[model samples]
Target: MSATDEQNLIEVSGLVSHYGDRQVLNNISLDVRENEILVIMGASGSGKSTFLRHLLGLKAPSAGTVKLLGRDITTMTRRELFDLRKQIGVAFQGGALFSSLSLIENIELPLHEHTVLDKDTIQIMARMKLEMMNLLDHEHLMPSELSGGMLKRAGLARAVIMDPRLLFFDEPSSGLDPVTSAELDELIKQLRVALNMTIVIITHEMQSALNIADRVTVLHHGDQIFTGAVDELHASSDARILNMIHRRPSRHGVDSDYIDQLTR
Candidate 1:
């Protein structure tokens, strides 16, 4: 591979996915460079979530390849895949912390499961991550005790506790007030610089995408319609892109034949 290719932390080429008879992704391709934040945005049912799943190796693509940290996931053995996951972290939209576990325990779970670290060492490491997220004082609290923004930060703390090389966040700004969402955006950027990690965020919030993304990729019905800098995205005259930016309904009306196929 060339040096530029070597620098890519994540690469997806001609990826396709299907759910039963329905095709969710239509030949997508993208690259995420090291320490860069790439935002994937699309309306609901636009396959952004499906694409994230494929990237995470939660689901295999029907065709093409996904490479992460110079490894082709499609060809990796189960054991190899398991090892690959240790270098990656994911923060779900709802934080996905276990209610029964304290914040510190949640962050330490990965260290305990993935490494042979002792209890004191693990607690220390987890607390360090909590400090990074500014949640050291709340480490003893359950998920229910935190506010929405705190929960998101706590999830992020757990995600980066292992010092992952790549981080994926699903809708980090979802369900947050404007000020809190902006704070989260700043935190994401800070983490990338502090950890030197490649970050991928899947979101529909246009403001968040424009603010945090070094590059933005817009998905329309599973197809990658746009991938470029925020200014280019704003300058584009494409109807789909404009509709997405302006929050207008899709111009492509659904046809009756497609509806019939869905029913059948």
Candidate 2:
């Protein structure tokens, strides 16, 4: 890839975070190239979600910086940050759709809230996004009416309703069966190609990571242990990376209790 190909759409430098005095992220740095699907993987409590909050500007990093499209979001004025957020979209874990609204309404909410478009126009755009996510027929369905996979697809539809340049997904396949999860993985890849979206995914699913990731960053103990292409991750000889890829047992044939406690 050329230098321009590596040009960053998102950059994090020396990131740090904490809950009270318990440090979570520590000196993290990473670059997300434009239009790339960069998967962030880690064991639970590795601070992946905390890092994501910083990237979304929902939580300020305790130290260091998070820059989006070359602007330091942590330091941006509220107006500037709001303007920047309009270009990005996030699909939080569990879909996070409005429980009271139908799929169409959920998707249209962003347009209604952020743009000056009339309801009819917003409805048309929302339908288009639903179609893109293979969810045209589910437009009128309420969140409670959809299956786990459908809920995820609906949330994805909502996230892309504005045709965002960058899309963030947290645990895209959580609480899903393998077959459905694999289908969702294929959909994610399709969306990226069709929309040319830069995707940042926070996931612990090794299969999902291997299937759709163009590049993967592995976090451990609040620090990055690996950041490279999927092939590099697979070929790496690093003990932590190897164990993660293979889902191997620890030295005692059992992961640490805290680590072993994570359900997914």
Candidate 3:
């Protein structure tokens, strides 16, 4: 292994996954470098979310190993995985905040559950993260009261409250105006530098990926079709990659045998 390989915070090797009879992921392998933003890009039903679940050890892979901070998450005991998760954070696509809790309560929930820190310390830490995400003034609002951008920021504030070594964000620009999406993209880059955390973002937005990705891995129908810098992606001649990047509809044919079986 090269010195660069030694610096990888998360390493996924030949990962495969399935939901019942349907295979969802092929042999997907990736390494997330320390302090870098790696975007996972794909259209809907392209296995991006399934791949992220494998990374988080949310679903056990059918084969292969996923290593986070040098520990194999696929094989870890529930207790072990829970302990290790303290060093990792995730911000879901829709913020996933509890509607019943205020923003500050939601943000500080992790500290309350995982740490023995005093209430004052937890509150202070939550506020620090909120301030970092430019959300300090809106800490008292409920999830339903906040705008999409503000909710994303609040989710992010919670994700980083633990000061994790690695962060996973799902669709950071999913449903927002162009200017708000651009602002969120900038916030992601800023968080990477400010927190010194390795980030893996799951997004289908080409503009957002290009805006913030240090490198990107593109998935197509469970296959890892491309993984490289944004410029390389743009310069590629592969029709599959180009079609995805250009928002062209896929013209793939269906399997005749599968159709016959379904109709029979």
Candidate 4:
């Protein structure tokens, strides 16, 4: 990536989202550096997924700017938006592969939809990606035949098949065993190095975030509570940070005495 690209693959400022009168995200701003693994983390209702929707141009931000390669998407025309979004890839939380199609078919779906590549070349490219993810043999298998980890890998392979400069992952470790999750983390790091791709992951798995994030951004009540290196987060003295790291019960539902004892 060029120096300018390294500066900001994605930039969001004063971002907000609402469903009817219920505000989901509030005044959020963050930059995703090229080739950096940025982990966006928060509690269940902290707006992590909603923030991603804004970043991906799937939903309009209520009051903010979302820039891809420095072009604000909020005001962009449909053609411009489509052109800009072409440079990004998203791996959904559940893999979201077509249940009826084979793995290779699922991976090739994007290329077929977006590009003019010939059938033979697209097949070759799809196979290469499947092999890269160690799923070559399973390319003929349907989604129902794959394990949870394999399904995730297949989805990741499909995400990168288009060679997107920006990659988005939503809970890559959602339903896998610890060993499988760890292996997926290793694959993520490897892909980052190999493709020099900038990654933005939204997840609540502390271990996964700490293991792979170049930097971690924690959100609380729609505000950024912390942003720093993993080690800094581990060593920080901030109450919110400490509470999150140690899995402490929040005072939101607890009695005052319980909160006091917990804090003490």
Please report, as a residue range, the 10-residue window in candidate 4 with the lowest summed lDDT: 1-10
Window of ten residues with lowest summed lDDT in model 1: 247-256
Report clash pairs, candidate 2. Answer: none
Error of 1 at 18 (Å): 0.3
Off by over 4 Å in 2: 1-6, 252-264
Q: Would you list the rank order by lDDT, best first?
A: 1, 3, 4, 2
How does candidate 1 fare on TM-score? 0.93
Off by over 4 Å in 1: 251-264
Candidate 1, residue 4: the lDDT equals 91
The lDDT of each candidate is: 0.93, 0.89, 0.92, 0.90
Compose the digit string of candidate 3's lDDT tens values, residues 27-127: 99989989989999999999999999999999999999999988899889999999999999999988999999999999999999989999999999999
Model 4 residue pairs with clashes: none
Superposed Cα deviation of residue 79, candidate 2 (Å): 2.2
Candidate 4 C-alpha error for residue 44, in Å: 0.6
Off by over 4 Å in 3: 1-5, 252-264
Cα misplacement distance, residue 218 of candidate 2 (Å):
0.3
RMSD to the true structure for each prediction, in A, is 3.9, 3.9, 3.8, 3.9
lDDT tens per residue, model 2, 1-264: 347535888988899999899999889999999889999999888899998999999898789999887789999988999999999989888789999898899999989999899989999899888887788988888899998888888888888888899999999988999999998899889989898899999999999989999999999989898899999998999998888888985575466786768865
**In angstroms, how far off is 240's CA in candidate 1?**
1.3
Q: Let me know the TM-score candidate 2 reaches against the reference structure.
A: 0.92
Model 1, range 1-264, lDDT digits (tens) per residue?
A: 899988899999999999999999999999999898999999889999999999999999999999999899988888999999999999998899999999899999999898999999999999888988889999899999999999999999989988999999999999999999999999999999899899999999999999999999999889999999999999999988898888887646668788999999
> How far is 165's C-alpha from truth in model 4 (Å)?
0.3
